[model samples]
Structures are given as structure tokens and as C-alpha cells.
Target: MTARKKGPPTGGSGANAGAPDTLEGLFPRFPGTKDIRYHPVFQGGLSRWVWRYYTHRLTRAGRWFLGLTCLLGLVGSTSLEIQTYIPFLYAFAFWTVAGAAAAFSRPRVAFVARHADRVCAGETLPVEIEIEQRGRLGGADLNVLPSGLPIPVDAIPEGGVPVPPLRRGEKARVRLGLLCRRRGVYVLRGYRVETDFPLGLLNAYRVFGEERSLLVYPPFHRLARMEMPTGRRFHAGGVALASLLGDSFEFLGNREYREGDNVRDIDWRATARLDTPILREYREEFFLRVAVVLDTHVPRGGRRDEREARRAALERAISVCAGITDYIARQEYIVDLFAAGPNLYHLTAGRSLAYLDQILDILACVEENPDEPFAVIEPQIDERLAQINSVVCVFLDWDETRRAFVENLRRGGAGVKVVLVRDAPPTLDPSGDERAGAIPVIGRADFERGVEEL
Candidate 1:
């Protein structure tokens, strides 16, 4: 949520800028009528009513009927002056006012409450709205404008029937159905509460705005790389350490000797008394962590081609990171994410499945900036390399500077996996020997195939 800046108070913004003399002076004053009620007003009694009937949507047939009615009405009032028709007009006016008053007496009403601001994808949350009558009145017809989400309804009208009448001050709690099908931010717009009130002759409506936002994280995806080092000890060359018994690591409970069991694993002291030999073991040591770096900026090339290439690259990077995080987490190893975008994002090492959602949320909103260079942030990335066991760099370009940075990371005893977003020519040394001491440079195709293999 963004912070809101406070502005000058309401009273300070107008000509009557001085503080209110009394508490009542501070509040808004409505003119004349003591009752704060709104009623639909119409003009010209029968004439207006007849005009409205004539204008019941100007179709060809409707216009002909309207002309015929006007002609007949004019002929029937031939002896009566427009003034002589006062009594009839008065009666019509009285009936119209009475009808409007009756409708307002039981104005249909609705109130929104218990709204949920957060929900996960594919999850349904119940929204509550209270609808009631305004005064000592009863209303039948009610309708909601700009309908809500398409979720199954839990409760219909109170009775096992539709269109139930509501009494004055009596309320019905409505549970609006809500469903989320995708992840990201969702904004809830205002609801249009409406009702026909006492009669179906006229409809009344009101707009209700209760601003809300929801942040949804992406769903989890499985990691398939089994050979990837997990929570296991590795030498400088990234090889898992062999577990040998009778070593100084620690002494675990002895177990029965099996075929091909190493003699060094045998517990000789236990073997002397018991007929069978037992082996001692220690808990495995683990020293593995992964640092994921996503490069956000894509350089200009062909318009669509560059965009498609950049998009493909970003996807590959996200896929690789997801796989690595899942694989490492499953194996009890820690993983962290570092984004080299206009917005710098860093998540510390964690071993839970929950972090996957967090990482994906950040990835979903990540975009490239033309001015930012992935190389410019190398120093900060280097600073974080001390604790991370491996650095996975996902970038579009691979120049000498980037190559040196990767080489430096490797020299600093950190494993480096460079997933190039674009294809790179075979790496050549300063001496022009393309094959000697060339670091493994996986192109976009290579990375895609690698992920599939994993």
C-alpha cells in the first residue's frame, strides 16, 4: 500500500476559511425541507404521462399509436378549455404525488459489509451485503447493477422463493459469491445497489464505493533436476562427499551388517559380544546454496523479434530459477533470488516451499529497462556471493566484462552457471583457442533443452 499525503483541512480551502464558530457551523447545511428524502419529480401530470407513454421507445408502430392517441384526446376535450380540464389534472396530480410518496415511504436499500480484500487463485470468498427497507415501509423488487463475479450462490431469498418482500427497518444479509482465477493484483470497483421500491413503476439506484485490492501469488511448479546438488557436502569441485563409518564426524546408532558392507564400517567392539556386526553413521553434512539473478533489460534489435527474444529469455530464466529453487528446497538446501532490473529485489536464503510464490510474484511484474546495464550491478552481486554457494546469471548479452565477472565469481570459489538469453558464439580464449579453458556457455536453446532434461 502506498502512503497518502495529508493536505489542508476542508475548512481551510474556502472563502469562509476561518474555523467554525459552532460545532453545527462545521457541518453542511441542507436547504428548506426538514426531511432528507429524494423523490422522482415529473411535470405536466396527464400530458407528461401521455407523452411518456407515447415515447415508449420510438418504434414505427409506437409513433403511430402515440399520434392516434393525441388526436383522439384532443377531439374528446373539444368543448373543454385547457383551463376547464383543471379538476381532472388536479386529480391526476394528487394520484401521481401519492404514488411517488408511497414508493419513497418504502425505498429499497442496501449496505455492503464484510468484504474480503485478499483471495488466492481458484479460491472463492463470500461477500456480505445487507439490504433493508428505509422507513416504516415494505419493498419487493431489488436488483444489483454491474453484476458480481460468476460464483455459486450460497443463500437465495430468505424463504425458498425468489423476490421476497422486505419490511421497514428489516434487513436481509446477502452473501455475494466471488471467485479468483488468476494471480496478481485485483481491484474491486463500486457496486450499483438498485431497487424498484413500493411499485415497479419507477426504479431507484445508488452507487457504493469501497476501494480494495488483492495480491495473488503464482501457483507452485515442480522441480525435476535430480542430479542437482541438494543438502549434501561437496568438495571444491561440486562432488558429493562419500560417507565413511568409524569417522570423526559423529557417532550414530549402529545397524546390522549387510552384504558388501565395508570392513571399516563394522563396529568391532559391538561385534565382539554380539554375533552380528553393527555399523555407526553420522548425519550428512550440507554446504549448498543457490543465487538466482534475473537480468531485466533487453537491448534493441528488430521490434517484435527483440521483444519475443527478451520474453523467451525471461521465461527461461524464471523456469530455471523455479526449478533450481524447488530442487534445492526439496534436498534441504537453501536458495535465494536477486533481480538485476530497474527495481532491485533480493530474497535471502530460505528452505520452505512458500518462498516459491514470493519469487514468482516478483518475476511476474519484472520488466526490462533500456538504460539499465546488468553489468553495472556486478559489484553488489559480488558482495552477496560470499554466502551463496553458486551464482546463476540469466542475462541477454555476454561481452568481455560479463565474461570477466563470471570468471571472477568462479575464481572466488563460487560455482557459476550463465544462462544466456541469446545465442553466443563458442567461447574463445585471449590466445584464440576456442576449446581450451572455455567456460560452458548455454544458449537459449541449450537452456530450454537442459530444463526439459532436468
Candidate 2:
């Protein structure tokens, strides 16, 4: 369990001021929110000191300026160098020492922050940084930008975020923005605080925060505008003569009144006629079991680049799995997702608000496994095949083995739908699992359109 972070500090020192207001809270608390992570600190060693303080990444202009300083020093070392050049050497030396000295000072302000890091892919998240310092911040001398970000300009600060004046104790706040590009867990090492006080030539920065993690979940998509087909009842119970055939909720026949039975639902007429307590007996209801299988296996023995590409393709498949789970659960079915990761998992995704959150949390961190075989989940699927009304199969590759697997589900009496994701090429050869056969096969890229056609 994770501690639910409260709304961004109302005082304007936190990220999103409140919880995410998205589509009906369809989002989950991103994958990782447990534990505090530390950022790298300087050790007392010559190499560490020189690397952390004396040197820094030079801005374009800073690079040229430093090169010029070096050239001047070289000329001064020669006795034969002109006297006019000697003035240039002294001027450069003065600026370097002064700029370095001003920026090299440790930050007087202490910072603390709160971030709403959990977000769906492609959504913007807010961040708030609050500053507490014993001395006033002087102008822009104590500049604050989120460090360790590839693009520092993206973190937007909140309005009225005072850049505290120097030498006076004060408080300050800054808000930032984050863009999550993919579905997975990301750890933020910490924000970098840098200052170019006396000269912009050398911007000295220090790492000043603990690490934070963000979990980005797969984006949800509606399969189609049409309604999902509820299956014929595969279990006992329920008055749903039609739904009893196979769907989420079913009505069962009345039974003898029980202590726990809702008093309101008691059948008065039956009680009066029999002169005894009788309750409306309904069958134990269960939803059409939606078995969603995500094939995360990537062929082994490929180069690093090739394997990376395969992983990307598999990620798309995972997104498709998320989409299908969302669609089925929204339709009010019990979605059983059999996905392979570090260990094979069988997740029961339900329509209840709490269960939906749980489902997305696990999916957010699932990784692809190349060593695991696709056949591993087949037996589990077979075990529950009798109850499953429909089978949605998502795969990374296509071969005789997988084709036979889909055929097995169909043969077991479950409605079969195949999603051949981007990684696998279509098999045109005429066979039971081919496009020419009875089973419906759709490419991952065209999943939405395929569902519409279905």
C-alpha cells in the first residue's frame, strides 16, 4: 500500500494543488510510491570535490570564454609575449576568480517539495517546490531550476513565487510541469540547483534533493461505441433467464428466509401464504469471465538493438491489453488478465472502483519477459476455459504454436478474438488460425477499427 499524497501544498509550494481531475478518476496511483530514495552526495576526496564543485557543464558561450582564458594564460607564461597581452591575462583572471567565488558558495536556502508523479501517459503533472532559508535571496542570484532534467525549461514555476531576497530569512515556492512519454516506472534522482551569480560564464550547480518515483500507466481507449456482447450463462444461479445464459449479473430462484437476508427484499406474500418466513432466493451471480492473455515473450538470441525494438513492440501490446481490460471491465464483466512478467500473473480486474485502481497499478509496472515461453499460460487458460465466455488473445509473434492455442480456446466453446500486435507479421498461409479461417484476427494498429467491425 502507498501513502496517498495530499493536494499540492495550498500555500503554493507543491506540485498539482489537488488530485488529478481526469475522466471519472479512471487513473490509478502510479506504480511506485513506496520508500524515499537518496541522490548522490559528494564524498571528501580530491576527485569528488573537483568534479562536483570546480567543474560543470559549460554553456555554449561559457565554453568559448573558458577557452579564451586558457589561451591568455598560455601566452603570459612565455617571457617573449607582448606587454599589451599581459593586461588581457590579468583581466580574464579577475573575472574567473570573482565569478567562481560567488557561485561556489553553498546554497543558504533549504528546499522541500511535493510531486503528483503518478500520471497516465501523455498527461501533464504538477510539481511544487518550497524554499526556507535563514537569509534573503538576492535578486536572481539564487536561481532555482529543477536539476537533472534533460530540458530544464519545461518545469514552470507558480505565480508570485518570490525569488527571496539575499541576507534576509524568507520562504519561496516554485511549480513545475512533467510530461510522461511512456508506460512504466521512472525515478527522479533529484532537482539540480545551479547559480551563475557573478558571471553567466560558469553556472555552478549542486544536487539538493531526495529521489522521487513516477509511474505512468497505459492510456485507456474505448473499443467502440457499440455495446459488448454478454455471454450465455456458463454457471448456476440467477433469475436472468437471458443473462443467466452468460453475463455479469444473474437472478437466482428464491430460497428460505435467512437472518442476513435484507428485510426489505423479503417476499411478504410468500411469508403470509406459508405462515413462515420466506426470502427472495436469487442464484449466486458471477460475470462472464473475460480471459485476456497478453503474450510478452520476445524471441531470444537477438542483438541489444533488435531486442530493444522487440520490447517497444511488446509495450504496444501491453497498451492493447490495458485497452481491452478497460473495455471489458467497463461492460461490467470479471476481467481475468493472464500476463507474463518476472513470474506469470493472473489478475482479476473488476468494475468496482477499488479493484479498477488495483488492476491498473499492477499493469503499470509489468515488464516483458523473453525467457518465458508463451505456452506457460496455456494450461491456466484451459483450467478456466469452461467459465470464460470470451477470450481476447494479444501476442508478440505468430507461429503454428500460437495459432493452435487460439484454436484450442475456440474448440473449448469460448468466443475467440485475436489481436496480432505490431511485432508479428501476418500469416497469409491458409490454416485454422489464418485470417481466412473462422477466428477473427486483427492487427494491433487497427484494434479500434477491428473491434468496430466485430
Candidate 3:
């Protein structure tokens, strides 16, 4: 016989020999049946029913009773015993009675709320609400709960802000302290007025719709001193020319009048003394204009933990930028903020022209951009590079893109200061290009503990 043909190994030395063939592998295009229990139609209905039962119909005691009823029903169904069915039926009847009582016990009320337009993060926001009973029946055991705030339940009182029993047409005012966790613009959607009466097996609540907005500014350390590159460029009309149009000039010595010279500049005394037309020469005002370029670009596509770390780094960078702006605001320099997030942001504040609060407002709304932001930011800065004396760049990473951006700024004759915000010590040398100068790396831990000076 011819030499036996070699065959593939059945159980060894083959990639798929020992692997079990799965149905998914055999039919890659298989459209498997979805679990009906988890379908949106079922899930949404179930969740809504559960929420309504818990919030509107069920109380703490009712939940325990319901659980016991469910256990009894399961046992009765399995054993088909009359004795087991009796307890389940009794529990079910009690639940039905409790729910009916709660449904009719809902408090009919109207309310109004007032709060500040803005609050700093990590601070307690006080919301003042005035509730009035509208129904013929008096409202009792009322709880005022603010809705649409990202506040923890533990932060608020267990039963919410309790209001004493109110007679018909009576009103009560209560203050609710909302704990702000992070910085962002938030809207207070409404307030829920809830009460549990009678059997205390359910809570009857009515939601009052009230739309209000609140801005939360990021919390930042107050820097005692911040070292920035020393530079001042000539401002044609100083703060007036930079912001508005007005007179901002310094008087120099007297000189002969020119044809285009303003008649107002003619020095009558000098002209009289010299017996010739002489004019007072003035120079344009000069001041420091620093650009605080905040890097809000967060790379996309990473593990959950990695994405979180990147976000944390971005927040730290924001805090650093806030601190720098705070320090610059105290000085006499004109500060311009350049941040590239979802959109490009540019704000000018300083010399009493604008308040620091405006800068904080911009920072509050800044979001993370996944794409490289330097491309958009470079063009923005280039347009005003001639006016900007120094640039304070707050970057999350010191990668090639950022390095190139900074290098370009230095080439454009801007005094640049780089601040790298990272959780760990930086691995890449930020000073690889001497033209960018030495960069200061600020660790997240140090920032959290507080950096008094930068």
C-alpha cells in the first residue's frame, strides 16, 4: 500500500483540537433570541411599577409585609396546600387595602422655591421653599424633597425637610441644604411633597414642577504666590484699548507739532515759551497680558479605570488653571483665558474691566474634548499672540502634540510657562526642548492636599 497519508491530530498539537465548538462560532451571523424578561417593554413596565409601589404606595412596613406575602405565595403555589394559601390571601388583602388608602391620601399642595444663581462646589446650597396646602383637607406629616439635584440621600435628613401639619390654605416655608458634589451648571427641576399617613405602609407624593438653574464653580486652592514669566507688551490704549475705547496714554517731553497731531496735544505753554508750535508727546500704555491656555483634551478609548484617571487628571488641570487665574487677577496684569473643550473659549478679565467670577463661569462650563485640541487652540492663540505677553499653559499631558504646541508658542515670541498635571510623577521629560524652558509638574496628591504656591 502507498505510504499512509498523514492526517491532522485529533486531540493534540492542533489549535482547535481540544477546543469545544460553540454555536456562536459555527453561525457567526446568528441572531439569538433576547431574554424577554429584559426586553425594554417588560423592563420599563416592571421598573415603573416597582418605583410607583415603593415611592407612592409602599412604606417600610409594607415592604416587609410584601416580601412575606411573596414567600407565602411561592410556597402555596408549589405545595398547592389550602393552609399555605390562606396566609398568602390574607397578606395580599392587607397589601391591597394599604395601597388603596395611600392612593387616596396624596397631599394636594402648591409650592414655590428660591435659590441663588450660583454656588461653589463642595458647599451646601440652601434652597428656600414655601409650600401651601390647596386641598380642603389639611396636609399632615409633610416632607419637602428637592428634586433634580445630585445630592446624596444621606446628606439630607432621613425623612426630608419635615413641615408641621398645615390647615387648609395655610403655608409654611422651609430651607433645604443641597450638598453640591462637583462643578457644573445644574437645573433644579422641581420639588416632591410626600407624606405617609394612616397605616404608614406607603408614601403619597405630588411633584410640583419648577424650573431653575444654578451654576457651580470649581473649588480651587488660593495660591499665595505664583511665578510667571515677566513680560509686558505695549497696549495702544492700555485697558481701554484692550477692552474698550478710551484715553490711556503717558506724557513724554514736548516736541514740535506734526501735521496729523491731535489739536488737543498742542502744549500752549510750551508753544508760548518756544515761540513756535510745539506739542506734548505721549506714549501708548503698556501692561502685562497673560494667556491661561487650559488643555481639556481627554484621549478616548481606554479601560474604565484608565478613563476615570484621565478625567481626574483633567479636573486637576482645571483646578490648577483656576488657581493661576486667581493669582493673576490679584495682580495688575490683563488675563486672557484660552480653553479648548467641546468648544473654544476665550475670555478677557483684569484691570477692573471684568470680574474673576466671569473666569470661574467659563471654567465651570468647560468639558473634555477627545480629539487633539491644540490644532484649534493654536490658531486662536496665533491671532492674538502679538498682544499676549506671557502664556500659562495648563496641560494634562506632555506629549509630542503638546510639546509642539508649546514650542510653536515660544517661536512666536510668547513667554511660555508649562504646568503638567498628573497623578504620578511625570515620565517624559517636559524640558526635552530647551526652547520651551523648564516645566513644573504638579502631582494630583499635592494639589489635593493644597499647593500654597505655584
Candidate 4:
């Protein structure tokens, strides 16, 4: 939830007549038709004082000019004494003070904003702001100043009148652009709204209270070229007839419908004479399932640089997972994903894009943790192997431990392929140099080629 701010309710009609002498006195005596709240934000103490001093100097200089002119006239006057010029000097000083006061008297303005702190990495979203005038503003212009951004700048100032006359009881809107670069939670800072109207000398700014952060998930790269073992394909609510001839996993029989037989499936002619409902039996065949494995351990490639490299590796893994999920889902396979690192994330088998999106989000939040070894987590994965027919493993490099695990799965009758992302060399060396067999090893530079090979 965001907090609400109140600003001065009234604004200027055109100029002079109704302008408030000062911000403090501009408070609406009786609340106008619209309610205004004051959200007072003082610029830096030193800065504000400096600005005040600068305005005072300008006023003094105007007064000095008027005094010098009056003195010259008094010296030139032959009939009137110098004392007569005193009244004229006083009037000139008053006008000088009025001019400076009007220039410095800024309207009290408040800015309210709301933002979504977190979005999927690579997605663009809008940030909204509402601004209201406080007192009778002589005139004002509102702008959302640009600042450093992590994501791509989309549309900023979500389309408001480029320049709107902020009148009493009136409000204006503004928006900004944002783009997500990569996965990770980021704190939003330096978002400021400023106004420099009436007098461009001073820029009045206010910070929106909608202080929030964004959590961006990593981009899921497309893995359309992943190697997959062919399996049964079924239409929604339809059973495969070929698998039903003794090879199907389940056996169902024709039965007489009690009360609700699908009208389309009912034997209408038979029912018309005997008034009995009959429906055809469906022999359902289960399709093969594939599990996606992401090795989240701090590998040799990951340890290249302490923090940045590890972060990059995790991002790559998440992106690969997204691509894998998309590719497998397109082929109509039940795809599941499992990650082992500081913590373990397991996504159950599903073909829906929504489910895959959830998996991608999990991948976005994944990070390296110095906990449970890969071998220890292997048993946890083994428990779910019955439902999975094949495994597609995504890892940074190929090593003995990974090879042993792949061999274990292959010997257990599971079709396994290792998709090693060789951005860097493996930390462990090969003992018995066995030429690569079925699984393909891919390098980072050859990612495009790997996609085709897979």
C-alpha cells in the first residue's frame, strides 16, 4: 500500500490578483470543492538557505538601484529638498520587495506515485504519478527527471499533457519508462519529480512516497534444439487408439450410462429403441515424461570471479531452463525441472505454459548457497524417477561426478543426455579419456551451433 500526500488546494487563475503571499498563508481558509493535503519536503537545509540568500541579494540589488536613482534626483532637484525624495525612495523599495517576493513565492506542490517493484526480467511496465497543486500557484510546470536505470527505458511519463497549467483544485499525471535487464531483486532509487515554472531560477522537487523495489527474473532462453526421445502424443480428452491394442497402460471397457451419457458419445439409435444409454470405452495411454536438471553448484566457470561470474552463471541457467521449458512444452511433453544448489527447487510435471512460467520465476530467484552436496541431493531426485522417462541435464561443464550420475541413470533404463554449457573449463580433470558417446558437449561460443546440433 502507498501513502497519500496532501498539497495546497488552490492554484493561480492567471497571475497577481489571487496569488498567495507565502506558502504558509496560502492554506485554504475554507476547504475548497477539492481537498488538498500538504506534504512538505524541504530541499537540503544548506541549499534552501543559499537560495533564500540569493533571492534576498537580488531584492537588495533592486533596492540599491532605486536608491541610487533617487539620490541622483535628490541631488539634482533645486526647489525640493533631499527629504522629499525619501517618500519616493520608500515607494521604490516597496515595489522592489514585492517583485522579489512574487518571484520567490513558489506554489506548494505534492506528487503522489505508485510503482510495481518487481516484474519478470526482460518485461516492461509503467510507473504512474499524480500531482496536485497546493496554493494559488502563479504558474508551474511538472516533470519527472530522468535518472540511472537498470532496465531499458520504455515509455516514461505514461502520457500526460506535455505541459499542463496547474490550477487550483486541479491535478496532473505523469509516467516513466522501465526495462528489466536481468534476474535479481533491485532497489529503485533517485526517482524524483521536479517543477521549474514561473521562475526558472529555482527547481522545486519532491520525492514520491511510493518507495518500492523490483524483483526481476532472469530471461528464459529458448531451447528449441534440445534432444528429446520421441514418445506418444495425445489430443485433449482423446485416447490413442494404437496404444490400446495390448500395449496401453490402462484397460477400460464399454459400459451402459446410468443417467448422463455424453450426447455425442451416446449410441442414439440403440437408445431410441431400447431407451438405454451406451458409450464407447477409452483406453488411455500415458506419454513419456522428461525431467530438466540444472546444476546450480559453484562450478569452475562460476568461480571465475567471486560474485559477478556466479551471478552470470545462475542467470544463464535460468535462461536455459526457460528455453528448455518452452521447447519441451511445444513438443507436448510433460516437462519437469529440478535445481540443486544452496537449496533445491522441484517443479512437477506439467505441459502448461503457465506452469513453465512459474518454473522460470523460481529459476530467477535461484542463487548459489554453500549447502548440501550434489551427490546428497541426487537421492532426492532419484525418488521421482519412476514418472520421468528421459532426463536433459544442463550444467556448466562435464566432470567425473556428472558423468557417473549420467551413467547411473542410463544403466537404470532412463534415456539421458547431458547439455554441458562450456563457458569455461571444468575444475576436475578426466581420468580415463573416453571419447564422447551419445551426449553432446557444447561451448558458449558455439551456442548457435549447439542449438542446431541438439
Model 4, stretches more than 4 Å misplaced?
1-124, 128-135, 145-163, 187-191, 197-202, 211-213, 230-254, 258-265, 273-275, 299-311, 370-373, 427-437, 447-453
Error in Å for residue 391 of model 2: 1.7
RMSD in order of candidates? 15.0, 9.9, 14.3, 14.2
Taken over the whole model, the C-alpha lDDT of each candidate is: 0.49, 0.58, 0.72, 0.53
Error of 2 at 41 (Å): 21
Question: Which is the better candidate, 1 or 4, if ranked by lDDT?
Answer: 4
Prediction-by-prediction clash tally: 0, 29, 1, 20
Candidate 1 per-residue lDDT over residues 1-454, each given as its tens digit: 1112243222111111232223432112311111111112223477444433332212234345445545555654776645544554554564476457544543447565576555444566566766666755566655543222111111122111223577877877655545544443434544445454443333344556554544443333465643422222343322233212211244667888888878897888988879778877655344566766666666666677656666556555555555566566565555667665445556654444235556655554444555545555576667856666777666565556567766787776676666555553423332353311323344666774565433
Better of 2 and 3 by lDDT: 3
Global CA lDDT computed for model 2: 0.58
lDDT of 2 by residue, 1-454 (tens): 2212332221111111122233321212111111111112223366443443333434345667767877876776675546646766676886668576655554666778788767776676777877666534443455555544321112444111335455445667776666655665555556655555556666655567576766667666656542333366545542223332243334566667878878876888988999988777555555576778888776678687767667766766776677778777777676778876645667765545235556666566666675655667888888878878888877676677777887788888787776666634544333353431443344545654444433
Tens digits of per-residue lDDT for model 3 on 278-349? 998888677788999999877789786877788888877887888899899787578889887766778888
Estimate the TM-score of every prediction. Answer: 0.49, 0.70, 0.77, 0.61
